[model samples]
Target: MPTPDLLTGELTLTGRITTASNATFLGTIGELVVVYKPRAGESPLWDFPSGTLAHREAAAYKVSEVFGWNIVPHTWLRDGPLGEGMVQAWQEEDPSQNPVDLVPAEAVPGSDWKQVLRGQGEDGQMVALVHEDSAALRRMAVFDVVVNNADRKGNHILAMTEGHRHGVDHGLTFHHEHKLRTVLWGWIGDALNADELEGIDRVREGLQGQLGQQLADLLSAEEVEALALRCDRLRSDGQFPAPSGQAPAVPWPLF
Candidate 1:
């Protein structure tokens, strides 16, 4: 069988992801599965301008690509059955491993995982949120920081086979003001690894070339400049940053 042409192949809506604030559809391009977020289906958000979420999603994919990290699955803007939207290749996550998990506080394991924080569950039981201490997740955390991702919920981190991690739902990103919220705060203040710092450097360089030109089509001038500033700041710090803005540190419904 030939590879499915995601752009031109017919899109069949498989299901609706109703939990999403905006209308999200599970779609298929021949045998290839994908998630489609149409611009027309997007709900209004006070912080972000309306009808631009799809472009933001595509911009996140471009950033991930420039960093040479397959953090976000292959995504692009296209005219789909629903309308013009961002379509991303679907990632079937490994059920056994989760990048972020909430375990009983007392039961938190000592090895392989880093404890993020402790909190009470709805049942009034103590729970400790933890994330795998691996290079994949650290890369994703860096990606989020650069994008200023404001809604990095736990479930958005997809643990794929062979330890690959993919981040999704990046519509709320690249705002001029600080708006970084995420569950991947376990590495705060940690020294940036050589590879991570190199990725940041590559992105900074790309911002002056094709990456910057492409982003100019998707984001505002101020937003693009802010992205460059984030890259500079992260490079200068040489470490994972602590939450600085007044915005909430994590998104609600921790997953």
Candidate 2:
């Protein structure tokens, strides 16, 4: 089958994703499946301006494209059945593979996974939050830092069948302030490798060209500047930063 044109196709709603905080819908454009979140359906957030969540989602995808890491799926803003919204190609993840997971505290894998923290489970058993230790996930962590992602829950990391990891639900990104809450703290304090530094350099360079102009349409001037500053800071430090804010380092409900 030919690939559907996401930009100009007619989006038809199939169903709602009720678990999402915003009014998200499962949709289709011809034979292509996608997820849609309308600007009108966005819930009010105190820190973020109302009705801009969809724009932020698109901005995240733009940055991901600059990195060439494929951290986020193809995302863009378009008019859907509900109205103007953010539409992204739906990714079918491997059910058996979990890049991020909660396992028994003692049973955490030593070599393959990096343990984030240990906490009590709902049943009062001790559990540890862990994620795969791999180059793909490390790139995602760097991407999250540069975007100032406020929420990077375990569920947001999709483990694809071919071992590629994709991140989703990036509405809480690119704030001017330092609101980088995430579960990918496994590489904290580790020096960024050459490839990671190259990716950051690409973003830094893009900010002075087309990427900066693209973000200007989706985010405020201050937010875009902050993104540039983040890229510069990460390149300067050459290491994964530790959480450094009064707010919680990780999001509530880690999963």
lDDT tens digits, residue span 84-189, model 1 = 9999999999999877899999999778888988999989999999988889989999999999999999999998888889999999999999999989898888
Per-model TM-score on C-alpha atoms: 0.96, 0.97
Off by over 4 Å in 2: 1-4
Worst 10 residues of 1 by lDDT: 1-10
lDDT of candidate model 1 versus the reference: 0.91
**After superposition, which runs of candidate 1 have C-alpha atoms over 4 Å from their true positions?**
1-4
Q: What lDDT does each candidate get? A: 0.91, 0.94
Candidate 2 residue-wise lDDT, 65-118, digit = tens: 999999999999988877899999999999999899999998999898999999
Count of clashing residue pairs in every prediction: 0, 0
Clashing pairs in 2: none
